[model samples]
Target: MKIHLTSVLVDDQAAALHFYTEVLGFLKKHDVPLGEQDRWLTVVSPEEPGGTELLLEPARHPAARTYRDALVEDGIPLAQFTVDDVAAEYERLSALGVRFTQKPLETGPVTTAVLDDTCGNLIQIASRPR
Candidate 1:
């Protein structure tokens, strides 16, 4: 009846961790090594520590690579995160050197921006009038 966790396929988990935490401000929740090269890593929004977690899953499967690559090639975002102010968040992130494919644009009552996650995914940040 409720959402629990979701994931983004990442080319490098370590780099994704840094970008999601240090840049995007999510807090690390779980970090367990699954094998010699992979770890069961997840992060939660700082504002909702007990909310759904976002897993930074490794893109080890060939299908995952093809899917992600195709999405990127088509300028589609793999995931979207909600924020309070899309414009402010876009400015803050841009100042940190995050490359955005789409700048904040208003569409009806909602605004959104898309940025590269730096670990092989395009992410969208969105906000709607409160």
Candidate 2:
């Protein structure tokens, strides 16, 4: 089976959607009410419209709290996104006022950078030699 969806835990779904779409240039595909204030929101790559969905999940749950806290405490990265040009993407997002934890730097075969999502998640942007 193909991987159709992957979830990212966020403190606020709306804020995550804004960051993913408005800031990162992703496109929103589905956003339906899940009940109360909860929503089943998703984003897709602009280049691959229906390829995969990034589930914007709330981190208020006990399991999510534990998992996110553990990662933050250990200073470990939470997720990585590959880009064609990390430096350019980094600059573009920086201009949009995104907070970056680390500047872009060469790491062996890959050049990478890191940023905070403001929702207890560290996002990594990387590019490898072609």
- Most TM-score-accurate candidate: 1
What is candidate 2's lDDT per residue for 16-96, written digit by digit as tens? 998999898889999999989989999998989979898898777788888888877665668788899999999998998
TM-score of each candidate structure, all chains considered together? 0.97, 0.91
Worst 10 residues of 1 by lDDT: 121-130
Q: How many clashing pairs does model 1 include?
A: 0
Clashing pairs in 1: none
Q: Pick the candidate with the highest lDDT.
A: 1
Inter-residue clash pairs, candidate 2: none
What TM-score should be assigned to candidate 2? 0.91
Model 1 residue 50 distance off true place after TM-score fit, in angstroms: 0.2
For residues 27-90, write the lDDT of model 1, one tens digit per residue: 9999999989999999999999999999999999989988998999887999999999998999
Worst ten in a row by lDDT for model 2: 71-80
